[model samples]
Target chain A: MTRDIWKHLILVIGAIIVLAPFYMMLSYSFKSPGEIDRGTGGFFGRQEMMVDERCVQLRDPNRDEIAAAAPQYPGKSDREIRDAIMEEAAVACAMRPVVFNYTKAFIEAPLLRYLLNGVIVTVSIFVIQVLVALPAAYALAKLKFWGREAVFGLVLFCLLIPVHAIALPLYIILAKVGLTNTYAALVVPWTISVFGIFLMRQFFMTVPDDLIDAARMDGMTEFAIVWRVMLPTAVPALLAFAIFSIVAHWNDYFWPRIVVTGSRDLFTPPLGLREFKGDADGSFFGPMMATATIIVTPLIVAFLVAQRRFIEGITLTGMK
Target chain B: MAVIDAPVAARTSREVNRQARTAWGLTTPALALMFLILLVPVVVAGVLSFTNYSLGNSSFDWVGFKNYDRLLSRSTYEKMFIATFTYVVVVVPVSVALGLGAALLVNSLGRIGDVYKTIYFLPVMATLLAMAIVWEFMLHPTIGVINQTLELSCGTFLEAIRFFGNGCADGFPLWLGDRDYAIWVLCFIGVWQGFGFNMVLYLAGLTGVHRELYHAAEMDGVKSAWERFRLVTWPALGPTTVFVVTISCIRAFQVFDTVEAFWPQGGGPNKSTYVMMFAIFEKGVQQNLIGIGSAITMLFLVFVMFLTLIQRWLVERKVHY
Candidate 1:
């Protein structure tokens, strides 16, 4: 037990370093701009009220409004009336720092739309990958076919081509087709995951020939067997691959950054956070961190919930 | 290829042909997509690397070896190669070592080590761009948590050290902005983000090491744990080490997300962190210089494929294990 104490000591320190950014991100999201600038407050901030400068700025009184506000203070000069109206605007905009940070995060950018686009792209990519991969994996694993070796060899060859390395031609192709700014450019290149084909083929290799033979005896067509028999048996690996695909495409910033140039509505979470950072000044730090926190929370939460599957999924891909 | 068909004499030729047809039907989509998406890109990049091609241009002159020559001669491209090789060189060994070390430490503690494993793996699971942004904030020169914490050590006895004293008297280093510190900071984050992955792989490798080898080594008078590891664990982990090192190299070579996030303008202070992936993105996608980008892409593919082939060779040889 005493010897174990030192091991625990080292691991605890590593944990602190690993968790530091997360700690900062969450803390900054809660902090007011003043607290963030001065670097005070504990994990969660004091929740003190702060005014939204932009909100108040937009409500700045013009000449006609100051003249119309003469009813409330008939004897007062226009400057005094404007001062009182400005104070009222400030009071009206006052809210807790947490509310200010979160609201501005959504309002200042289309964060929800970005998250939705992230979902759409990742889901469509994974579905298409499975649609294209599973049948080929089925053919490679179980079917007695000519050119099987050549096909598997081609898959192996394709595995050597890192998709990111060839982004130039992919981008050019998308541009040639006038699909550069569309979702098709984001989804099309990744539709064929050679790694997926390779992985599923490996997993399918372990299943018994007798199980597949039994399905054949039931008068099932080969397509039905693929969708029904092999698919069920391959669930554990497929689950891992699903998490793997989602995490990768969801967090993918490069391809989306390349293709989704002009459209804010089409931006993924990473691109949205990046665009937010582009426009943010010092005073926007709280809201910017808030944007980051929201962007990262879903997968982190899912990971904390099912860490085993996430770890297995992530590491399993390295087998390629 | 003929071997699998040898046993098919027992089956009818019609059934065999039916099976082959089904297989072709099933694999055609994947094959076509693979050809278009994967293979054709290589052919395109290879063909276009010999020419000065842009997206909208109708005519492109063949510029044989010029792109490669510029890559060899130009100072900017020279910095790109240096920065890239430097990152791969530093990141691969350090992260692999940290990974193996952490794996050993965590594996020894049994179930209690899972907390550390989970914590370490968090960086891998979370979005790297989001984390990179957070890191940017943390590495802020003035009000960042790192400098703020460093300021705490100002008047302490630790200031007797020159680096810490320099940090104390003057301001702490401007991490991302300072050229001297930028690449190393990026490398540091790369290690921090990536070692967890290698640690996970190492932990998996550790499980495959048989229990009786240690017992056998102990019976053979291996007194220290280091000797046991040197004899039994290291040899047993030979395959895993090769795999971890190769994957780390590929990943290290493709270190773009952090580099792009940190130094989007010119690939860091004076292009100190100008990695190849960023170079491709900058030249091809950003500037529409397809010729240079294709050249860099071809070179990147060669390096990656070469590393992969070496790993495949090593695994096939089973040299140590």
Candidate 2:
């Protein structure tokens, strides 16, 4: 059991290295620019009130404003009135760093919109993938078909050509068809998940043929039996495939970067974060990390809540 | 009896025909989408590789093998090959080994290991682009926490090392900006993000290894842990390692998100991180050099297919089904 001490030591170090970036990302999302620059703020950072310089800049008093504020100042000098107004603007703009960072995460860009787009694209892709894969999987597994061997062979071949490799031709084809900058560009190419079909087909093969036959004997059509009998039995496999598809597409940057070039509305979370990094300056690091945290949190939280399933789902690809 | 047999045979033939029809009905959409999306693009890329076809251009001229010629002869493409292969070569083995190592360690720890498993796997779950951005921030030259931390080592005994001494004297390496460090940094990130996945796979494989085997080996006077592992565990993990290595290789080959995030304008300093995936995107999509991009795509597909074929061969021939 003492040998386990060394094992724990090694694992703890590995854990720290692995968790460092996550810690930094979360920490930066909380700290002010000053703290981040100096690299001095501890984990949650000092929650001191920091002025929103941009907001204060917008409120820089003009001559007419100073004259207008003169009355509120009573008999005070114009300069004093201006200082008072400026001080008021500073107070109005002041907020804690945590609020500043998270607010700007939403406000600086259409982060909420980007998040929605991510949901829309990832959901549509998963749903469509399941739809296309399930029946085909069912047929390949249960139904007797001419050229089933050929179809399955074709699938094995297609799996070799990773979609990212052939993205050039796909992009060209999409551009030719005027599908780029649309959700179709994001979702169309992924609709036929050959791996999903292959995995489900394998899973469906393990299912008892008698169950399908029982449905058929009840006068259920083959399609009906597939949806009613096979799909329900394939839930575990489907859940795994769903996790795999959603995670990949949700965090997908390369495809979305290619197709959804013009429209901000169409940008996925990854794309939006990339754009944030693209234009980010030193002061903007806080919001950028906040954006990173936001973009990454959903999946990480999901992974944490259901660690076993998430791991199973992600590694299901390895079953090949 | 002959009349009855004939009717039964005829009825079965009709049923077979009906099942085939239904099968076709079910499989048609998948086949059509697969052909349109997957198979057709490979063919299109094959054809497009020989031509100077941009996206918007209606007409283009064929230059047979010319695009590939550039890929072979040009220095930039040379860098691209160097970078891509360097990433795959370095990341694959290291990550696979790390994964195997981590898996073994975690397996021994029992329930306490689950925490480590979750922590290591966090990188696999986090959006890689976001993490890449964070890494870039930490690797920033002057103001980054890495350099700031290194500066802390200035007055320490650690300064005896050249890297640290140089930092104390001149400056620490600009990790993403330095050609020497850029690719390696990317490789480190690749391992960090990837090994956890392989670890998980190996953990699953471990559960399938018979517990009785270890006890039997012990009874046979298998004295040391190393001997036990070498005799029992390693052999049991053969198929899993094969699968893990192949998957890791394919993943390492497709390392784009981090590279693209790190250096959006060019590949890294001196094109050290110019992986094939990024090269395809840059040449074909961004630069509108479709022919050249398609050429790279063809090469990439060949590499991937070759690896997968090798894995299948090993799985069939060496590993018992």
lDDT of 1 by residue, A1-320 (tens): 89889889988998899999999999999999889888998888889888888889988899999988899998999999989988999999999998999999999998999999999999999999999999999999989898999999999988888998899888888888899888899999999999999999999999999998898899999999999999999999999999999999999988898898997978999999999998899999999999999989999899999999899999986674
After aligning candidate 1 to the native by TM-score, how far in Å is the CA of A155 from where it should be? 0.6
- DockQ, per-model, please? 0.84, 0.89
True contacts kept of 1: 0.82
Residue A297 shift from truth in candidate 1, angstroms:
0.8
Question: Fraction of the real A/B interface contacts present in each candidate?
Answer: 0.82, 0.91
Query: Model 1 Cα displacement at A316 (Å)?
Result: 0.7
Instruction: Give all TM-scores, in the order shown.
Output: 0.97, 0.98
Give the deviation of candidate 2 from the true structure as CA RMSD.
1.5
